[model samples]
Target: MSDFSRLRHCMVDAIARRGVKNARVLEAMRVVPRERFVSEAMAEFAYQDAPLPINEDQTISQPYIVAAMIEAAEVKATDIVLEVGAGSGYAAAVISRIAERVYSIERHETLARAAIKRLEDLEYGNAKIIIGDGTRGLSEHAPFDAIIVAAGAPVIPEALKEQLAIGGRLVIPVGDDQRQRLCKVIRRDATSYEMIELEAVMFVPLIGEHGWAEDGSRAASNHKVGASKKQSLPAMIAEAAENLPDFEDPGFGALFDRFADRRVILLGEASHGTAEFYRARAAITRHLVTRHGFTIIAVEADWPDAAAIDRFIRHRPSDQQQEPPFQRFPSWMWRNVEIRALTEWLHKHNSRIEEMEGRAGFYGLDIYNMSGSIGAVLDYLDRVDPEAARIARERYGCLTPWQKNPATYGRAALSRGYAECEKAVIEQCQMLLRQKLNYAGKDSDAFLDAVQNARLIASAERYYRIMYYGGSESWNLRDTHMFETLQHLLEAKGSHAKAIVWAHNSHIGDARFTDMGAARDELNIGQYCRQSFGDDAALIGFGTHSGTVAAADDWDGDMQVMRVNPSRSDSYERLFHDCGKVRFLLDLSPGKREPLRRLLSRPRLERFIGVIYRPQTELQSHYIQAILADQFDAYVWFDETQAVTPLGPEHHRGMPETYPFGE
Candidate 1:
């Protein structure tokens, strides 16, 4: 056989050895051209079962791991499979042949772009590549038939569980850094799931948003392939807490100072659409920027808006100049809370924006119409055909077509005459509108007129500065626009200058941690920035406090909130509940407070019954009167020792339950 055939046979054998038996998966693997997905130098090893290094420190998953995961998932030909790691797009391409649709994510720009090309070249039309975090999963495309994690994680993430379709199976390596076992968890029903251990395997640690941290990754590597869960949560927490770096402590203020007397770039989370969040983020960004010589501010708005910002900087009229505009800004209904808040904030800040320009001409980091450039097209379409415009508006307005919905409005537009040449009038109107919206807002005649009157430097700047933000999709364009904006800042604004990126967490969090079987597998701005700046770039995830409710008004305030009662992880049948308070033990040392533990290993009582304590009622002063009436486990508290111990599963039916067990 030829070299290619030999490699294919070797790959198949490796996959079989891994216990992957699905015929469809094997055939898909057999037929797909892996060599095309890799570089020429490594084409010889394309069919190897090992991961090959790719650009940006990313690697394609080993072929056996990929096949085992796909087979374990039982991906049906009709099922829409969500592939979390689209490193080389080889796995996605193979799955594309077996699954109805493949939504793959990659955080590295080089990998994402490469995957897009490889998949496209092979005519994998069923596949769509998105550049976003996958750890959160594609909530918009909730109910995926299968989800395959390309990397190993310390635990099965909560977000992925929520995103799984009913009865869907998720194949992932779930364990500590020391030892990880392939765990296949099936969502048995809405409220429950069944877990089955598959086999032992190893792979690169998943690094994205919810993946193991560097410490956790290190811990995993220290253990053997299969280690038992031997440590308790409190012990582990204490160990991790004690071993953390000094920078994690309050004394690390000096490091912040060392970074610079330069400027404070306070970033806010804009992932959720609540206007309160954006306002909070903007206010924080402004306060920090203003306090620290941050004359030039930036946002994810369009280039035209950026230009308008420049005009504001130069004290020029904005109404007549159409180039710098808020074309991508959504003006539709108020259903999309995030978009609504963003638009309102954009409008309300016009005066503040003017002030910012006066301070130091704030630039729209996203100078091109990126994510919603199509929204600009639709806005222009409205002027030409009002009826068709209404349909398009309804198409996107009612549903967040930008999400991972099966029937996206953009896809529909492509199917209809909307994307064809037959709609010449509409198409021309859109083209002209986009041109005006994205550029300096001049017509053919006006542009020439301005050119004839402008200085050489001005004309050259306009020509050099003019940029486009469109690519694979609206979302993808938005990211590319930010990257370009960063480029412009590094080149145009000057190097060593600081700039803040205002985008979703998906764009900010490390891709290795965040992007996975997600709706869109696009490169995050953080990933790009890190590649460019190395340790100079840092990603701080804005995570919500679990078991607490944060109100909208609390954005600007600080409050110590209560946490859910703590519970042990081992026993599931305990009647113990979270008391939602921090108990202080009298005998404990200043630095060593014992974590409260449950008295029993399992639930001994059939059920817990309670009664209202009233002044007039019998046994009102007896805290355990009911428990004394019915024999039950007695809890004795020693005030001096600051300790509580369980008495017993005893019966004292007719008496007030007394603290029989004493110090």
Candidate 2:
């Protein structure tokens, strides 16, 4: 295949994985020659999953957006479609490949003429262009089977709604210029219609009688609530955000000194597999551990898995395992080179400390290892008391059948009513708590570890039993467990204990300020920590505009090194990108950047790349509406970043293959 053809086919495949399952839409997008629609200078980026600037100060909507809109419109092969804002004529061409007749309208006469010339040259005879106000739509074409608008509107236009044929779909972005929602309006009858918000989007304002006035809509919609009129968002960020030196620089460590006094410091990552996030967080943690006496490094990982690493780092004895920790799918999230280096450094730091409780410690706050946690609890009880071990086994055995695939238990429990073991696990945890004094007298650390394992079992049991039905409440359970685990560790370590939490932005940022809380009613660890600890907790979030990330397409899928799409125009990451700084830190505390914080308090998009990333459907799948200033106290930005270096089994811990247990 030719280079363009190969790229086009790859783009189609990527979009398929991104959740666009419409065969007609995929084929239409695949057949269209997007490279010919834009200027020669922009040809290379034609197939990229991003909008490229075109003539008349307009943009060609990204390939995925066009396909998604077309799919949303449900354009049939015999359908007559209308496209508004035919910038570069790309969307019209794609629609023409599927629809029988296509009428595209543009306000700019030059763009309309250019689109017509390209359509004729490409022999797309079914597609035609006309000069008109797109927001008002093509009235002469009236009653189109489908209508697609490529610009943002303050509200759905009456004319466009009226032009939709019965049972036809009109897909458009409706909101202010800075942000909008891709809405699907289906005309059920002459006077009745159904509206569905598909996803968040950002588009140039549709300029016409039915759209915005001659001037732009941003200033009028946004007023001077934050920064003065003279300073734009990017300029304000550039002035407010602190430009930090490289990770190696001592000054870089000094930049985090302001957080030294905080009891709990949560460091977030833009993605699970970004090397820069890992390296930067590790550097900050190292500085805090060595200079500021921070004792704990808690993370979003399975409890049993993290326990192994914690033992290794703190010079404590651990049960010898057949394989290393984090061997499960997406193992690279914790079993990568950057994390390895951090563990080694923490181990060395702990070795220097004579006070056992004061030494740096590593721990996990997640609850995903029911099997391992069960084994740990049983082994501990067996060593301490045979009778308790037997009782524990009997109680935990109620859940043994579903331990490997706990999701089945949730469904089975619901279908088979009395199958859940909630009472048994709860009793087990209470039993451990009641015997805490008796166990502590023997070996406090071991007793605490065993009790925590039991607590995790109880939480995991509930997590699996309710996960299938709990929806957002289950997510709440997980985060609540993590927050409680952090509290447990702090309580166990004594009053002077300090902690540094390492997790993704979704877990570390205050969820109340994001769609997670506002739309779904989910609370995360950061929100809980802030409410419980107040000013003692510092929630820091992270972001990256573009580059690459090591992620999987689905849960338990093999990892792939995928290119990160450029941040959406409405995201804080994009605003940071426009600041022209490769990396910086924005401190939005009480006095640092009052104007910047106020500007950021307004809702905007924020990307959350977990172990999975879908670039094609990114806006729908990953980006969440967030008030950045309220979500986090400090924001770290990297304009571009590279994927983490995942370690092979032989290279575990950068040690020799002979050392299966690792360096």
Candidate 3:
């Protein structure tokens, strides 16, 4: 096979691996000569899956996205298809291979002429290019079997919908100019239609009667902006954001050498479920562990869930009957493929070392799993002292009633007759501390585990009770617990302990620089670490412009791999996207015009996606005000990313049926 043919097959194979299972769609992509549409200089990149810049500032869609759209449209050999905004004619060429005929429309006459010539030269007589407004869609050909739009439109054009044949599929990107989702609309009947949102996509504005204006007056898409958004900022950021090699590349670890000496390195993710964020954090963490001697790996997870992982990683024997890690809702956060790889690597690394203290330990810093912690404490005490176990069981019995739904206890406490159980949980924790010296000598690990569980129960009790009151009290208490937990973990490892934290950007970015602290007085672990560790803490945040994310529509809901709307035009993620590199690491540490400080002086809206994502109210739910220059020491950028591969429920071994209180 020729070079282009080999590259085309490779691209087809990659798209197939990413879940595009349609054999005809894969074959259509494989047979198309993508290199022929672009100029000779750009031919080398023609077969790459990434979108490539084409004529008139337009971008040819990524090969994977094109394949995905075609597969979603479900085109057939005898079908007649319509393609809007055929910039390079590549997608139309691929479609022509599978469909009987293809009619492509383009608003730009120059692009239309070029596409016509390319199609004719390649003997793709089945495809025809027309110079006209694509939004009007070619009414001459009354109805099309499948219509695919390249650019993002403000809304589904009525004319295009009217032109779809009965049972025809129309795939278009619909949303504001800054963010859009690829939606497949099917004409069910004369007036009925079915719309299914596929994934998030970013494309140049579809400029016509039904789309954005010519001057960008209708652009920006209701974005939140700062004082001055000089166009130079994005370019300056792109220049300063250092390019990074693939995560597994040796050079990728060297990029983090500047932060190797910090006592605490907090790696953050814009959303809980992007694969790149987890993989990137893992790479830097491995570098810190192997090259810099960082021994503690703490995360935003429950103590009991992570304890199971800790034992597995540190080569400590555990009861065969013990529950597996991450059994609750949103279990995919820690039970994903990327995390599984990290744990496997850590376990191997720890096994190579003989001293237990010298090996890196994985731990959770969040306050959840009160019932699990109670069970673990009782189990620990039972093995050491049966008397203490009985007393602990009695003390924790007060909380057994609310084990299924601890939030109800908070409401119960607010009522006139109910009493708070805070005192009982604390007294039990204090007793455990008092006997620490006596029990620790027997097995330091066992005593520490039991004591931490006791401590967790006390904190969780107060957390649940105050959560009902709302405001920042509960938020502050949670962060305090996390910070205190980190301190205890570090202290247990000695003054030489160097820790790495994995959490959402909201929990790791310095809240002082954002409205979280300034407006609501909501303290987070990032702010606490900065106050405690001072210059010894390095906070790095990760963000993406457009991609897929694993999220749920509601709390405690089933996980769905949903589309992450592109960054709002006025958000920091947009600026990073404009930087033009597919991915990079931008140093935002304070200095004299260093780390692009001048370019980032103004405050901008930053996107923060947690476990739950409600796209309908994304601006209000996800965006926050923050001065990026001070919010983090560095920012890792990925122009586009995909959702994490979530493990099946089989991974979650055993858990109490009433293990509620999942925060």
Of the candidates shown, which would achieve the greatest TM-score relative to the real structure?
Answer: 2
Collision pairs in model 2: none
Q: Rank the candidates by TM-score, best first.
A: 2, 3, 1
Error of 3 at 451 (Å): 1.2
Pairs of residues at least 3 apart in sequence or in different chains that clash in candidate 3: none
Q: Residue 240 in candidate 2 has what lDDT?
A: 82
Model 3 clash count equals: 0
On residues 1-663, what C-alpha lDDT tens digit does candidate 1 reach at each position? Answer: 777876787678656654778999998898888888777766866775555656664567667777878988989988987877788899999889899998987766778898999888888999988777666678787788898888778777777877778989888887544345788889988889888998755455666667754433323235332221254433322332211112223322222232234322323231232233343344434443444434445554444344443444334444341432432222111113333333333344444544433343345544223223334434434544566556545433432332232123334544442331223323333434354543334333223112111111122122222211111134444555566555555453345456655554445544432211011234556656656765565443221112322121222232222221222222111111222112111111112322311212111111110111112121111111011101111111111111111112342234222211111
User: In model 3, which runs have C-alpha deviations exceeding 4 angstroms?
Assistant: 1-231, 649-663
Q: How many collisions per candidate?
A: 34, 0, 0
lDDT of 3 by residue, 465-514 (tens): 98865556788899899999999999888999999999998999898777
Best of the candidates, lDDT:
2
lDDT of 2 by residue, 302-416 (tens): 8788878778778887667424678787798998989888887877888888878988888889988788788888888998988999999999989999888777887888778
Point out where model 2 deviates above 4 Å. 1-227, 652-663
lDDT at residue 182 of model 3 (Cα atoms): 92
Point out where model 1 deviates above 4 Å.
1-23, 26-270, 274-280, 305-316, 320-413, 416-477, 517-521, 546-663
